[model samples]
Target: MSRREKDQLHLARINFLNLIGQSNPSDAWKLFCLVTPNITEEQVDDQAETSSKLTLTTIPPDVVEMIVRTIDIESEKNVRLTAKYLKQIVDARDTMINRVHIHLCSQTVGIEVHEVTKEEPETYSFNVSVIPGVNHIDNAVKKFEEIISKPNTKINHLKIDWVRSEENRASYDELLKSLAVSLADFVEKVHVEELTIDVNAVEHLENLICSLKPDILKRLYVIGPPTCGNDKFDFSNIVILPQWKHLSAFTSSCCELICPIHHLYHISNLRIKMASTSPIDIVGYRDTLIVSQQRIDHEITISHDMENTKQMLEPYIDCSRLTTCRGYYIRSNEKRLTFELKHNKIIFSTMQFLM
Candidate 1:
């Protein structure tokens, strides 16, 4: 083995010694033999020297877990190949690792689904291009199916950026149906706290929303050009679950006009970007109720050409119970505007009361 590999093995043995609560020579030798291969007297002497040369420190498992969790899987794979002992450490702690991200360059499934634990929390994002030779849709579907069969696996968040070439664009509906069926099952298994989907294939936003299992969805963000010709996008067809509390949309002016904000009574954060001018009533029934409960927080971003700050601020001012309002606003160029409202009270002293 190389010098680096030898050093790693020595570190692993020291770590293993610390884990089993035996740091003395007698216990270390016994535990080392139990876990590692038998070694000669001369080899043991060399390993002891190597271990002594390095600073031996004991770290709590929770701290180690946090450190390991921060290392991306792809980077960990490189470290594992350095030595067998390191591989063991990674395998032992794989389940506690929470975040996993993969950037796809090839059309094939880059990762083996079986290698990862099902219950381990993971977030996945795919950046893929569908060229004549690259068939990402097929590969993606296969991976999706494999993940669904595992009972406890939950992908808390998923983002897909799909690009289709001019020559080899496939049927959008067929692809959507296949993906929907595969993901809808998994979506039902876990509470989908966040989801971001960007696709040029689907013409209507409602069609995309309809394809998902609606009951478990809490946050939905959609990004694409407007499909509906008018300012009002129709969301009447969608069944908004009571648990759904956040909605963000990036679309053309006409699409924002049709966005269904009235339907989302539970939503606390609503962000929308529109291309054209549209009248918005900020003090709607939902806002009034949320304000009463002290749960009001919202942001609305409109195109630069359509500026209506006074009109937009009218509803909030009218609904506010307090005479003074305190808030901050920052413009696109980093310019800031701040305001504060104050209240005054008067007190009478004993002498004043007597007079």
Candidate 2:
């Protein structure tokens, strides 16, 4: 190494330490990179002379933590590559990723990462697309796990959308199954507060939802494929899982729930669409909520046309004298259940009362 280059490198290291503490994290890192351009681990460890290069190991761990915490993910990655000690420190620190969105459409997979801030949030988008006949689902998931699996990382919101179309419906269907299996294996490593997913298959949905950390997941939204006629999406396996039972609120895409209404009573708030509404099921669910002490609100929309309102309500109450778009309240004990019939929708909510 030349004497002049060594002196310049040493001066840059001294300036980096001085500026890092005085300037904001983003500015400090930018300046540090400008001064130490393309400095490899080998250069960092060079023992050419006594006063030449400065190794990051000489810096105290507390100072390293402070520097890392202020920088962005990209800077953190660069810092980790500098030395083994830096990598360990960076790996152990908790990084708060405010939100993540994963989208799978045909053959392309998109990943968006959002960082939390008081004002507008910062977003990073990554789209990974493979060739026509290769399996890209596995590769996409691996990239996703690399971010979420970081030690002590907490994600506030996570959303996954599987956009399936008719162009390659069969191929997408097979890919969806593969994606589900991969997600089921690694989803346990993620800690997210709220999740919104678009899944069409019951088995795939079950595997993904049931694998989440129940204690961390509070709200879950499921968007299933459109249904017609008597066909319904079966949630038989999901209602039994702890993740479903512990949710504070749940929203489902407009489709018939194959499971009975009572299976959803435990959730505090609910918005669901039923393929076909039966007076028996509506009355039974109403009766169950009225007698229970738990407080909840539910809005159920009947997707199919309801031509006869009288026939629908006859199982629970007399609706022969009632007109369309009427709001009715049924009170039993301390609970009051409001039932509104508007077109094909039934909006009913239970009131919370102090015991």
| lDDT of residue 132 for candidate 2 | 65
For model 1, what is the error of residue 72's alpha carbon versus the real structure, in angstroms, after optimal superposition?
40
Best by TM-score: 2
Q: Which residue runs of candidate 2 sit more than 4 Å off their true CA positions?
A: 1-94, 117-134, 162-164, 168-175, 186-189, 228-232, 277-280, 292-295, 303-322, 325-335, 351-355
Per-candidate local distance difference test = 0.41, 0.60
Query: Model 2: how far is 130 from its true place, Å?
Result: 6.7
Judged by lDDT against the true structure, how good is candidate 1? Answer: 0.41
lDDT of 2 by residue, 334-355 (tens): 4455555667676656642211
TM-score of each: 0.44, 0.59
Using lDDT, give the best candidate's number: 2
Q: What is the clash tally of candidate 1? A: 6
- Error at 178, model 2, angstroms: 3.6
